[model samples]
Target: MKAHNSKKVIQYSYLFHKIGILDDEQYKQIEEYHGLKEKKKY
Candidate 1:
């Protein structure tokens, strides 16, 4: 469930960024944070 939600979040974040809702920094922040968490778990 968590992993699924994380994927959705990343997808949405990218979509938002692509559509001009989120900037590069904001998108990268979210992506990096989740990437770190996933790394820590694995």
Candidate 2:
């Protein structure tokens, strides 16, 4: 269970970091364009 949770954390972190590659303004624009406040949770 511990290992599984750690893997999830790593996955989430990597995903967010990948998204972070976009410029902040672009990201914000995307969120607003999509009417989202944050990334959707699975």
- Top-TM-score candidate index: 1
lDDT of 2 at 21: 64
lDDT of 1 by residue, 1-42 (tens): 676677788899999999999999999999988777667776
Q: How many Å off is the CA of 7 in candidate 1?
A: 0.8
Structure candidate 1, residue pairs in collision: none
Off by over 4 Å in 2: 21-42
Give the distance in Å from residue 10's predicted Cα in candidate 2 to where it truly belongs. 0.3
Q: Tell me the number of clashing residue pairs for each predicted model.
A: 0, 0
Query: What C-alpha lDDT, on a 0 to 100 scale, does residue 39 get in candidate 2?
Result: 32
Give per-residue CA lDDT, model 2, range 1-42, as digits (tens).
Answer: 544554565555556657776655655554454433223322
